[model samples]
Target: AQSVTQLDSQVPVFEEAPVELRCNYSSSVSVYLFWYVQYPNQGLQLLLKYLSGSTLVKGINGFEAEFNKSQTSFHLRKPSVHISDTAEYFCAVEVSTNAGKSTFGDGTTLTVKP
Candidate 1:
């Protein structure tokens, strides 16, 4: 079994400033981690994922995340954020044995101020 936790429920930042959304996971088995963004009234969009290979993973909209097995964390970061970046972000964990099943965190709402 696996569980995910998004440390912050809301993160407000000024436009063009760097931002980081913290995510942590707990699992007994190997798991795949993913970051997703949800715009208001829109479906979720894949931001980044960490299944294997390098610990660092990059995704759309100039976002990136580093998977740290030691810390059981996969934190997302963007050097510069825009007003358009304002959205709800989620962290998910999928056990390797369970291909499509995933456990998602509550979500972190990022509000970008212009």
Candidate 2:
């Protein structure tokens, strides 16, 4: 049994400021973690993943997240954001291998002010 919950559905911040999007999940077995970003009217792109190794994983556009086993969370963080960064973000999880079952959170809309 696995499920993902995105605490915040929307976040508004000014450009160059830092932000964090909170996420949590529940699964009985091991799994793969992923954060994807979708720009306005665009598709999603892989921002990062936690297949193995370090808990702290860095991703594109200066984004990063930490996999906290205890909390069952993988919250995304960005130090400084650009207006260009305004988009929808999703936290997703799947089985650890080639097995194909993906579940996405409703999504978090990030609004970056100019």
Clashing pairs for predicted structure model 2, backbone only: none
In model 1, the Cα lDDT at residue 81 comes to 98
CA error at residue 112 for candidate 1, angstroms: 0.4
Q: Estimate each model's TM-score.
A: 0.97, 0.96
Best model number under TM-score: 1
The positional error of residue 111 in candidate 2, measured at the CA in angstroms, is 0.2
lDDT per residue as tens, model 2, 25-91: 9888887899999998899999999887899999998999999999999999999999999999999
Compose the digit string of candidate 1's lDDT tens values, residues 1-114: 788999999999999999999999998889999999999999998998998999999999999999999999999999999999999999999998877899999999999999
Predicted model with the maximum lDDT:
1
The local distance difference test score of model 1 is 0.96
Q: What lDDT is reached at residue 17 by model 2?
A: 94
Q: Cα lDDT for residue 20, model 1?
A: 94
How far in Å is the alpha carbon of 51 misplaced in model 1?
Answer: 1.0
Model 2 alpha-carbon miss at residue 50, Å: 0.7
> Residue 18 of model 2: what lDDT?
98
After superposition, which runs of candidate 2 have C-alpha atoms over 4 Å from their true positions?
none
